[model samples]
Target: MGTSLNIDLTAPGARQLPKRTHVQYAALCFRIREGKVKVLLITSRGRQRWTLPKGWPMAGLSPARAAAREAWEEAGVRGEVLETCVGGFTYTKRTSPHPHMALVYQLEVVSQEKKFPERGERKQRWVSPKRAAELVEHPQLARLLREFHPHLRKH
Candidate 1:
């Protein structure tokens, strides 16, 4: 988590203020097994809310690259970034003081490692799409899970 302060740099008495840019990057990894679709979700260490493994994009890394790193760090999964993006959803930042938008990407899990190095304090779970929708705190993520259900069933 990070913090940013909102400073209004007005010349004198400006009626309208310029909008500040706040960008956040995130990724979602979905794994399908058998007839059920399972997504790797991590419970936040502080809030204890279940969410997709995501974070700010790292320097010199593309969104997809950052996503793969995040998935490995948070969920102990090694996945492939499909040529096509499954979908994306936006949500306001609840953890940050500043009002920021979080961009979520859908990634497919190709493989998984046995251990997670960074998220020792947090709990990771592979949940069914239906169960995921109910467990995630964000409605948009829940909708994403729903959208993935039909496609996952086919695989």
Candidate 2:
């Protein structure tokens, strides 16, 4: 319980830094098209790796809500955040120089932005989930997309 109390804030080495699991909200952003599930993937700004919309936790917002906000900023789409998330995955956060555990949620996209933030810096595309799985670099995230059912939501 007191492990965190021993962490040194100014530690430069990752080994010296407390082993903490950073959190992020990832939108497994998708849409229904002609009775099929179409997943939206965006190109990462630096390496241009195909990936989902994700961001650090926002103030006063839940994980799913932050996922929605990230969708708007990164993919230029607005969506509905479902209470149920597919699962979580991990990736090394470039900015932080450490791995982050990302909670992935399904978002039903409803609208797109014409001139939103990060425009022209990244490319967004809509493709079949299987195709998206093949395109994305994250293994766990790819598996999640490949296994996600189009009819997941129950009404």
Candidate 3:
């Protein structure tokens, strides 16, 4: 009998493969008043970087629905999710346990509570649209803020 070497083809680096990814939904909630457009941003609990309210999607609900829920939970604001998506951008999840692609949405802030339960954990701010663009760390999100500037101005 001849000795033979058996290779495991499914090994991690056995083949060049596409990176695995999951989809995460996020909400960019804006409050426009007196010709001034302000965007709600949250300081992440983990990274402490200023970013829009977002999280993983939920079962039995649409992406927009998940965005709405995240907005409420993170910012203590309730909003109406527009039928149209203002924009979307992809971001690599370097810190998340699993790799993810975030689908961002625009939500109109209809109402808000005086206090948020997670206020201690997260810092929320309503900043000018232009300032928001500068504040958020994500370039893609900043672009979206600029894209929505016209609509935000009118409202």
Model 1 agreement with the true structure over 1-155: per-residue lDDT tens digits: 11112324474664443255355555667776885667777887778788877777689987667777777887777766542345444555566555444555556787777777775767888888778889987787687776663223224
Which should have the higher TM-score, number 1 or number 2? 2
- RMSD for all candidates, in order, please: 8.5, 8.0, 12.7
The digit string of per-residue lDDT tens for model 2 on 6-110 reads 224477763442377687888888788898889999998988999998988999988789999989998889867775556767888577776687788788888
The better-scoring model by TM-score among 2 and 3 is 2
Deviation in Å, model 2, residue 71 alpha carbon: 0.3
Q: Which tens-of-lDDT digit does each residue in 86-109 have in candidate 3?
A: 565556565755555567767778
Score each candidate by Cα lDDT.
Answer: 0.65, 0.79, 0.73
The total number of steric clashes, by the backbone 3 Å criterion, in model 1 comes to 0
TM-score of every model versus the real structure: 0.72, 0.82, 0.77
Better of 2 and 3 by lDDT: 2
Give per-residue lDDT, candidate 1, residue 28. 68
